[model samples]
Target: MCSHYEAVNKPERLKQAFQVAMPEGAKADVWPGYTGLFIRRPKEPPQEEGVAPWREAMVGSFGLIPHWAKDTTVCKRTYNARSETVATKPSYRDAWRLGRRCIIPAEAFYEPDWRSGRAVPTRIARSDGQPMGIAGIWTGWRAPDGTIIRSMSMLTVNADEHPLMRNFHRQEDEKRMVVILEETDYDSWLDERNAEPRTLLKQFDPARLTASV
Candidate 1:
């Protein structure tokens, strides 16, 4: 699963890609606890309804801690929710059922290849070096004082047999990668579409993708 990634790193890049500004002070490199941006429909009424209509950009906790969780500690293990079981997983089910979809932007994400019995850090990015619009889910958590703390989690798919992805992770574990959405398909992914979003879970073309250790 993706535990770390680098964002586009420039305000102009974000505006060009998503028509949204990078939040002030948001870190370019993201980890479990790092603050980063996510795109989702605003909850307020008169909601924008097009493919990307009414989307709002917010800086939130990267690892999801369900809105109703008793504490934030649960976020440590909920960073990446498996697409196949996301709708049924305890930590992610509610958000899935309620349409808490989002996009996590990243320039590159890191994984480890254990082909040589050691953790080797590898970076995955588009051959063009543009930012990847990663599919994700988000929700708002309430603090003790009634303030809301938003958080999000990346959606991942099994990649055990993938030509590029299979090289990562320990040999004994299942290989998985975050679902990266094409910019043109952003609206479909954000809205309720075709009843099965899994249909959009295509693995990136390793040919157009570059990976380096």
Candidate 2:
């Protein structure tokens, strides 16, 4: 599960790569509680036909805050949601059911390698050096003061059989990796009508990934 990552902070890069206008001041490094950028369909869709599906970038807390949560502390454990149980898990089910799908653009993500008897922080990025478009879900939570807080969580799938992803985490723990979306599926994955976005939650191509300690 991804709890730490290097966010794509350059506005021009975001605009060019994801075609969304990301606001300035996005943090370069993001952790569970850090505020980061996410790309999703605009709250109001364009009425004109023939126009491409529009996307907008917004800032949100990295950890998902359920509507029922009293505070933001829950973000510590909600950064990554298991795809298999997301539809039923209390923290993620609502977002999934409501189709709050999003894309998290990251320069790279960190994972732990324990094969050497001690944890080694490994940086994982695309072999081509482009930013990664990670599959995620987002939601809005109202605070006691009536302030709306947007938060998101990355989706992960079982990676026990993946050639590259299976090397991360502990030797005994069940292996898991985040769902990296293909460039071609970005618009489709955000379609609210796509009731089965869960089908896109699969391990990314190992050949397209590069890992360094």
Candidate 3:
């Protein structure tokens, strides 16, 4: 469960990596309930045929705000949705069933390492220093005031067998890591045609990641 992460925070990087414009007032760091950027399928398809943009980047709360939520505080607990239950969980099932998948771009994410009998905050980033495209789900919740609140949640899977990811969190708990999609899978992930894109929720390759305390 990742609650803190370093966002891309650069216009050039966002354009080059995701080919989407940077969201207005995007933050450098994101935490639960904070605003962050997510890339999802455009609401309208391209009218032209040649090289149409397939992704649309938008700023939203780091935690997901379901339609039934009374207020925005629910985001704090909905930031990370387990992949196994996303399709059935009340908070995330709507987005999952509607194929509202997204990509959460980040430079790095933080986790706690408990190898020494004490929790030590650690940073995990790609070994190559490229931005990461984490798999997620997004939705728009209308508030009582008629304002639409957009939010998203990172999708995670069991990582007990992962060589690198298995090192984080408490040893007594099941190891888990966010689903980081491959560069080539970006468009496919945002495609709404695949109602249940469970195949794309594969664990990230640990060899490409480096962790430091």
Top-lDDT candidate index: 3
In model 3, the runs with Cα more than 4 Å from the true position are 45-52
Q: What is the C-alpha lDDT profile of model 3 across 7-119, one tens digit per residue?
A: 99898888888888786966889999999999999877544333237887889999999999999999999999999999999999999988999999999999999999998
TM-score of each: 0.91, 0.95, 0.95
Rank ordering of all candidates by TM-score, starting from the highest: 3, 2, 1
lDDT of 2 by residue, 8-77 (tens): 9887788778887766656889999899988899977644433334887889999999999989999999
Q: Of 1 and 3, which scores higher on TM-score? A: 3
Residue lDDT tens for model 1, 47-85: 323223456677888888787789777777888999999
Give the Cα error of residue 70 in candidate 1, in Å.
1.8
Ten-residue stretch with the least lDDT total in model 2:
44-53
Q: Give the C-alpha miss distance for residue 16 in model 2, angstroms.
A: 1.1
Error of 3 at 6 (Å): 0.5
What TM-score does candidate 2 get on C-alpha atoms? 0.95
lDDT against the true structure, per candidate, is 0.83, 0.90, 0.91
Candidate 2: RMSD to truth = 2.5
